[model samples]
Target: MTTVTTNKSEPGTTTSSGADLHLQNISKRFVDFTAVDDLTLTVPSGTFFALLGPSGCGKTTTLRMIAGLEQPTSGSISIGGQDVTKLPSFQRQVNTVFQSYALFPHMSVLDNVAFGLKRKRVKDTLQRAKAALAMVELEHMASRKPTQLSGGQQQRVALARALVNRPAVLLLDEPLGALDMKLRRQMQVELKSIQTEVGLTFIHVTHDQEEAMTMADTVAVMNKGKIEQMGAPRDLYELPKTAFVANFLGKSNLMYGTVLEDLGDAVAVDASGHRLVMPKNRAVAHSGAAVVGVRPEKMRVMTLEAEYSPSANMLTGTVLDASFTGVSTEYLVDVPGIGTLATFSQNMGQAPAQRGETVRMTWEPEFSFGLDGNEKATEGKDAL
Candidate 1:
């Protein structure tokens, strides 16, 4: 393995091996519309990084540019410290697995996996193809045709086909979109394991948030042709930097609030005339109008007669709706002035609130997150 030495690439700086993919100021335009706008990202070598966003958010375009399928209108792409922005698809050290799989219907799985190796006139095609199939745990099906295999098996074959080339980076553009939910989930784990075992950089483009969060070592949330935020899955989910990310990544109970005081350590907030408190460091904007968000599971429910704690943030509301999921009961509550707020209470043997019933929602002050007031929570609606 090549040691990662400190070196300045373009648009950003990082210490990584040549297998890392770097895109600096990359953009793509179609006439009056731009698909990717000044995008810059660095995927560390051998990491499972996911470009996550809704459809038409330029994730696919970015992957295409990296794979040399789509040329960027500006900027540069470097792999293993070599410039490949001007290179054709076949010339680049990258492999792509499309949603369609594109396997040869007439060929056996072993031949399908070795197709690229044969084209390149590589030696020991059969030997290498079997090795690749074993990586994806599909070695037993090498003799089967594409039509004879299940969707998951065929997807594994597609993966095997790409891996046989042993490219520096493998780009997967919704490669599991065709599988059923259960199988997609199973493949997500399998794909991540295979990438880790081979120590190959994998850049996955997907609209599925769960799949991305589940498999990606690092996730970049794309919005409107730009990266809204990027970090580890847990960090991005627990502390979203923008309203769009708060909503797009997961469910967020966004409530409009006014800052009452910024006391260095903690800030006092008032939402719907109900008092609230959040850490000052968590305040996106202090001493002004803001939108404070909390994850549903962070909140707890209490009876109207229960005494409130000054240290906890509390809201008074009427239960407008409730649905009992297996592990938790999701509730929609209507606070007088702040609108509807969602809460998820664990099913530790507690009855759900009924419609029109008055209730109180409480959560620790540390769990509340502040967002920019001017930006609507639906800022990511542009994605499909």
Candidate 2:
């Protein structure tokens, strides 16, 4: 995994407090089922880390474990250099924003924000709540009940409630999942902004790839209760560690083949009758069965009649269908030896190719990647 330094901090520089959160071999089981299996990770102070995976992949369970809401069957959790694994939820210096917003339907926004402080018998609770609401730009709505507010406003209230506590770390579980696409995007930006302003460590759990890419300084892609890969958004997207990471994070066109030769920096793969050259990352080696994964945007369309260089990774195929999506065009191409492949082209005002038109598809050698050993041995089909 690569370490990324955001504008909020210098490279290799720790947060002001130097507080590090660690989850050491954390595991949780319910009777016969293991919700989280030996999960381990370290979230640097002030870093926006995302726990991303599909449902039942143990992301939420891991979050609950960190928040002290659920006790781990084994392992330990430490926050700010203190072992808080056995501590109750309130005893730990952490706050959570649930998906439901969990606002008091009857209490006004100001009262709801102040509830946590009041329960703790904190002095000047109203003043603290007003300041929190002001930070969220909702001070004007302090007197309004949750029922009188919109979805976005209610979400802000929830954020204010959590932020008012001034926890060292914040846990958000699909906080924007309740909003529509447009609203979700808006909230994503707002959440990032707030996190930057507060400079608190954020551990967000979500299955949305776009959401993770847009907001997180680092993304940990999980599968089957394990971290498949973890890195910066661009690194994970451009250079995936495994086939599961590649297909899960974005759409990909996979071609099965056997490695014909390894050239240190590049490897040759025999795709049925075609020989395709691909980049040889550390995980990929020579002379073995492998799969070539390419993103749709990396492929370019060419007519069968057009001459192509023998060095290029090209395949003859017929366009089975095409879909125009304003920004890009999607095509299903059927080749004799490769079966069907999905290709996409940016809409640059060019005329769309009609169905039944024979074309040659090509992509750069760097744009293609050979699968690692783990992916080659897995019998399950690719996710995309």
Candidate 3:
């Protein structure tokens, strides 16, 4: 049963700059396929939150549900303190900016911004539109059609339109997907600046890890219709809780091993008779075949004779490939029993190891993490 309620904001009325958005066990299904499953998240007021995942993940579906473009299959959504689960798009205090500019080619920039206000029959539409234009720094383009403006300018116009209403929540669904790489980066900075200036709740849905890390105050990493993990960008990168997050958000070199001892603060593991140590909290299970994870940049590779710390975890491998990309050198090493591993070393005036050379790798035990060897990061991210 569905009930429709008229919860519209009064004409010419804009809510406060921000309001908390809450979702309780939200799910979306299409026939036999499930897009989102039992997802619950709380986005604080005046925050920049990002939902990040791959193409088939439920990030976009979650955003559409918030915008009322798609209804949830179960559960309720609330903004501030009111239940908005059954409300229509116009009845909710939120607006969305899509990847497509969806601008009117024949309409002037000023008129485009004014259209929403005019529909609501608000007083002084022209004045408010100019104010919004000025906020986006496009006031001078008021008389020009959208066709005459550059891609970035047109994007700014769309942002101005959505923001002029002062909706408590501004939903951005890949708003920078249409811009070139350079412009996309530029817009990322601009958008964050604008969101901070307005103090509105911004929920941005995207698949780009770097973009989310660059702009979002908090990031929720999604995978296979569920949230894999959520945290600050640095936390997710440095201390991932799942193999999926470890691989998807950035690069990780995982080595499978069996647990030998569980120290109070760290766990000892044996990978093909070579002992390794990792922080205890990172172990998903108490014992058994576990996986040890280390970021490529954390492990150091040296010639067989170079002196390295004897207390740290060490492994030897034959360099399968080596490539230098100016700032850093990447190496692919093949160990006798632990499979292939990738490592990166910064080029601080030191020569890189050549391919086919025997090298020893060492890293601090604290930098290594223990994970469930059975978990597959490749799941759901590949072709069906």
Top-TM-score candidate index: 1
| lDDT, candidates in the order shown | 0.86, 0.83, 0.86
Indicate the TM-score of model 3. Answer: 0.93
Error of 2 at 315 (Å): 1.4
Clashing pairs in 1: 18-80
Report the lDDT tens digits of candidate 1 across residue range 117-194.
Answer: 999899999999999999888899889999999999999999999989989999999999999999999999999778
Q: Give the candidates in order of lDDT, highest first.
A: 3, 1, 2
Task: Give the true-structure RMSD of model 3.
Answer: 5.4
Predicted candidate 3 versus true structure: per-residue lDDT over 1-384, tens digit per residue: 111111111121233378889888899999989999988888877778898999888899999899988999999999998899999999899999999988888899999999899999999899999999999999999999999999999999999999888899999999999999999999999998898788888999998899999998788888878888887788789888778888888788887888999787888899888899988876675589888889999999999999999779999999999989888999999999887899999999877899999999999998987778797745433421
- Candidate 1, residue 299: how far the Cα is off, in Å: 0.6
Off by over 4 Å in 1: 1-18, 381-383
Q: What is the clash tally of candidate 1? A: 1
Worst 10 residues of 3 by lDDT: 1-10
Candidate maximizing lDDT = 3
